[model samples]
Target chain A: MPTQRDGTPVSVLARQLRILDTFDAGTVFLSLSEIAERSGLPMTTTHRLVAELVEERMLERLPDRSYQLGLRLWELAARTPRAMGLREIAAPMVQFVQGQVRQHTQLGVEGGYDVVYLDRASAPNAVVNATIVGGRISLGASAIGHVLLSDKPRAFLAKIVEAGIRRYTDKTPQTLDELVDVVDRVRELGYSVADGFIHPAARGMAAPIYGPDGRVLAGLGMVVPSGEPVNMRIVELLRSAARRVSQQMRAAYIDPDHPHALPGAKFRVLINSSKSSMEYFEGNEGG
Target chain B: MPTQRDGTPVSVLARQLRILDTFDAGTVFLSLSEIAERSGLPMTTTHRLVAELVEERMLERLPDRSYQLGLRLWELAARTPRAMGLREIAAPMVQFVQGQVRQHTQLGVEGGYDVVYLDRASAPNAVVNATIVGGRISLGASAIGHVLLSDKPRAFLAKIVEAGIRRYTDKTPQTLDELVDVVDRVRELGYSVADGFIHPAARGMAAPIYGPDGRVLAGLGMVVPSGEPVNMRIVELLRSAARRVSQQMRAAYIDPDHPHALPGAKFRVLINSSKSSMEYFEGNEGG
Candidate 1:
């Protein structure tokens, strides 16, 4: 494998991507020297790559000469089917859930070992929500993650357990046994309830959303104030919202007249139901 | 300059970016051959780049073996201060405007020669809106652009005119003279009112949002059904929302307690008002 001046066994493209990856939620702006330090690239190489990235408009320079990720990345990412596509189809349902729940409503999809949020709708002065759009939460730490992981195989759950879960709170699952128990409950009940899994003052609940092929595609969930008796009405509402999103997803894939219908593809007419195939849920999650 | 097998003068990073850029709004999914054809790269080069991109999780392979822009791009773009940052700050004001106008409310920032929409809020069953988040509109064609350009220099408008504006409708500004007239009106009124500029059935109105430095940061606007008499009350609502967004933006930069306050930075306090400096608007729009 070829390497840049850093000898990191990375391709030129990977090196460029590495530079971009240096900017995250906390470190949105950085000087070239800070970028060199964070990316571990020599100043000359970082300077060159940063200049090319600026020219390509992937990284923009601030007025103070600091650098940040540019709008070009957002422009490209806006076309992503996994994020924006599902969000567009699920927005109305999420809004419905948010309006009824009067808290935070979110949609998340599986990304590696975490559930990445696709969209979120929150009421003013809602309960504490740590999730942001395009943000991620560990699979063993939230109800949304339980819904996403409910369809995964035992081996996948074992691997996540072996990798070690971050204990967000004492209520978070700490072992494969705990994870499997929660996932099984989600699969059997068609919904999940995680009270104080992340924060002691908030509760999380979610239901699995399915794609056109009857495979689990994402999770629709909410965060509300904890300490109250579990509201079965809200749980039913969440499941209904998830079902609506699933129905919309299926219609988009099966109905040729749908605006989001696949251009030249065929799919099975999946019915939006709480039941899905659990034995064959170990497939790749498509965008 | 190093060239690929297709004899393009693009560097490796540029080639990779070009491949990502091929997936746009209309073309989200593509096969390997389709990507090769669209990117104008040789099949082998396209294959190698696509494989690398998949490994990097920049492009995801769909279940049909086609490819789409991946969630990782969205993940990275989520960290961009220009798009998501501004969108987060301007969201509430946009929502307020949407509530009052009962139409498609939007916030846009200047990108290159176009105005890129950062965020939008629409009521259910609202009038037709062609703009999307992270989408772009020509700077000379809409009321939002007029507010953004109200502070721009005559030479900048001339350059846009020389580039040959696309006539979306007969009501769109066709020459430098017409563009200047509308922009001058916007400058005088602290708001813009464009009737049937983009679509013959809709009208556009916007006001300028200012930054901490008193520079025009964005345009807060709304799209409504045309053919009705202009409602100055709605125009006042739009200006108020823009002012609220500007005040929030200014507060975020100046208040040390603000969650989004810049660390280790100081600047002159800026007051948010309808009036702003118009003589010095010709400068780089920073992220």
Candidate 2:
């Protein structure tokens, strides 16, 4: 739906973008004909566009003539302050939590109707979870997704429900009423629990991470074996970690003038303060 | 420079790409005017191009209107089959090695006169190495860089020497003769080691990984404390680990028809195999 300077429809740009979008968690690379078929463009058009993109280094052509995303894209994405900044601060804390639990720990942000994982860490023996960095899952089927959904406006939630929920597994809550009850529980308990929803053998616990204005900017979660029942102990640990991470995020608000802030210093401050806060709160709250 | 079909001189695309290239390990994010200055383009042209890129989701506008890379780019880069495929097979192995070494583990590919890091994992207590995922380093500087450079032609190495190398620290090899000798050593030993070259307090050892055809595909490395010398014992561990990871990569390559065989799977395989191979070999090798 793009237009050129002469007011003509720039279908080429749209087709090129469509070809790029055809790649996701499920489809990461494609043959030239596969791209042509997926984008519904003529073979010639797809070839030309793919060639132009490759020339610009926006896409890379392998030895097999198939196309994959280019380093240019990765270099560009590294500039996104939200993904880079948030992940930089949250990674050490996530690593610490993963070290203790010896499970999968992830940091995600709500994107439309799903939660997109930005960073993830896992121990070698950790339970298998289908989620990967840059992978997305439905809001109604993931603990991080539910935590994000619980923080949104009621009108938004209503629209999401009306759009229909996907049943990834039998544990996925399908009805609007069920989703509402789950959201309410998440708000009251300060966390969300998903049991075998996205994956049949995985359960997840998640809490919301806030930015400077206390807006629910991202969600932090842990994936464990489904055979282990969800317990208050795990929930409390997640909440405490989320709170500490959020507080650190609030402190390091990337001043415009100081664009080159020391990322390591920021991470150290977050981890140190978070550890101290966890100890102090553990003794005081006894949750 | 790029030309249009009508023979019109169109450096617009090239100029726009230069703006993107300005972002490297040293500069991840930049202000509007800074981009213009670095790209050597007029402010008006830079502004318009940046706007178009932002609209296309190639760049993201921060809360303060400063620009960073976008997730769209990350998603696109995630599709690069060659880099992603190798990383996918190697990540598990890399993670296992990281767990045992409790240091930094990285996977890199040769790019022009530099080595581009595809994936990296570091312990919270690990020595701070000025490298990030998607970042690049000079081929003649670090251990990984040297390993990657060992695969390059002699003319390329001479060109780099003639261009003059920037000395990062006192320990960095400044003379062309010294650099040539080090690269020769790397090719002979099948690995490279650098103490206090890039960073004064870190010692890094890297081994080149080969593909099914025995072509040097990527380099896997470990960065440990400099106080602990990188003796023959450490070098053997890295070489053996790289060899095992290369074997796993060969096994994964036979199935090109696999859906995830694209960028995502490729990346995961490289990272996973590298991590796992390191762990498997580390225990048996007794470093």
Candidate 3:
């Protein structure tokens, strides 16, 4: 593959993306030196790429001269229909769950062997968890993962299982067989519970959210203290919230005039109120 | 500007970004032809680029072979600290205000000549709004804009004013002088109220959120029926919420062990319970 002047194993577009990939949940602001080191590019190459990104407003300068992801990138993240829409629809319900459960209530979707949390309401001073909005964790270590795994094809599940599962705690599903059995249970029950799978003290249960096509689109999970007994009421809460979100998701894919929308699913959450006055951002498009 | 192979006045990286930008809140899914048309790129170029983007998982292929913003992009968005953090900290309070006011309550930051909404809790089926998350609106048309404008330097305000304020309704500020007085009044009272500015039937009030350094960071605004009198209680609610978010914003920028977190500002909102197991996403970096 043709590479940048720095001789990275990709195109210039790939090189620029590598520079952006250096940032994650843990690392936000970075100096040029830090960027170069993390991206494994020469300082001169990093400098040029950083300058382009900054000019395009995909990355911005902090007061101290470090760089952080810019407002423009976040805005694109905002305009994203599925992820942002799902979060909006699930927001009120997530907050309600967090209030009742008082631990961590989250909405997540499957991405490869991990489940990506889309939105969450964190209860104050809760037990350690492995999930947050915009954060992802291994499917082998949480109820949400099991819920997502349940809907996957047997072949896909077998492939990931063959790849191997890393145990997060002593109780996390460690072997391929264990993962397969857990998936079966989740598929049967329409919910999954993983006690101390992520953190030793945290226990969680997740219910699958179905789209209008009746395909599992996401998972709604609640995490609490493992010492507490399994709360059936919370399980019911998860199912109800997931049902509402699922109905909403299906409607987004269907036309407003389409009669095929599930009869009970009212898109009451989606009423987008804006015509989007984004003339200021029409320019400076950068990858 | 080194152009793409098609002789467009931009780099290949820019072309790729334009492709991504084509999918916004309104346009989530598009066919190859639609992507080419919307991005203003040639058919062959769009075809080759779309294939590459799908390969990289930046754009996902729907079952019908149309493309939509993929999960990877949402995951990238999740790692963004500023936008994500601000939304997380302000989520609870936004819901609170929405519950009390039963209106569109939102958080916005000034971006160029407009205020970009960060997060919002829209009251069910509320009045028409001119902005949404990831959406922006003119500084002369709403209370949030006034609060954001209030803290801008005199020169910056003058430029937007000179550029011409487009009136959304007859009541929207149209002149530089009216804009100036609105800013002055907002500064004096530490809040702003606009009656039927953006929509004929909507009124709004906003308060500025300050940073640890006391710089205005964002605005918290609530929109209600234009006929309703200005509610002083909502103003009080906004100030307290803004104050809490301001303190949290300062803490994010401060050291973990720093003794000076303003006498009473604890990072109570940010006690995210996640250990963040994003290691699965750690390095299959694709451009």
Using lDDT, give the best candidate's number.
1
Separate DockQ for every predicted complex: 0.26, 0.23, 0.35
Per residue, candidate 3 scores C-alpha lDDT tens digits across B21-106 of 88765566678998898888889989988887777667788777778777767777676665777778778888888888777899
Q: What 10-residue stretch in candidate 1 chain A is worst by lDDT?
A: A273-282
A31-149: candidate 3 lDDT, tens digit per residue: 88989998999899899989888876778887778787778777877756557877877888888889887778888887778888887777546666666577667777778888888
Q: After best superposition, candidate 2 residue A182: deviation in angstroms?
A: 1.6
Among all windows of 10 consecutive residues in model 2 chain A, the one with the lowest summed lDDT is A264-273
The per-residue C-alpha lDDT of model 3 at residue B11 equals 62
* lDDT: worst 10-residue window of model 3 chain A: A278-287
- List runs of model 1 lying over 4 Å from the truth: A1-9, A92-102, A121-128, A254-287, B1-7, B92-102, B121-128, B254-287
- What's the distance in Å from true for residue A113, model 1? 0.6
**Sort order, lDDT high to low:** 1, 3, 2
Candidates 1 and 2 compared by lDDT, better number: 1
Instruction: Give the CA lDDT, 0 to 100, for residue B78 in model 2.
Output: 48
TM-score of chain B of each: 0.85, 0.76, 0.85
Q: Rate residue A248 of model 3 by lDDT.
A: 60
Which model scores highest in TM-score?
A: 3
lDDT string, candidate 2, A23-69, tens digits = 65445567889888777767897788788778877777877777777
Q: How many angstroms is residue A71 displaced in model 2 relative to the true structure, after the best TM-score fit?
A: 2.4
iRMS, all models: 11.1, 9.2, 7.6
TM accuracy, model 3: 0.88
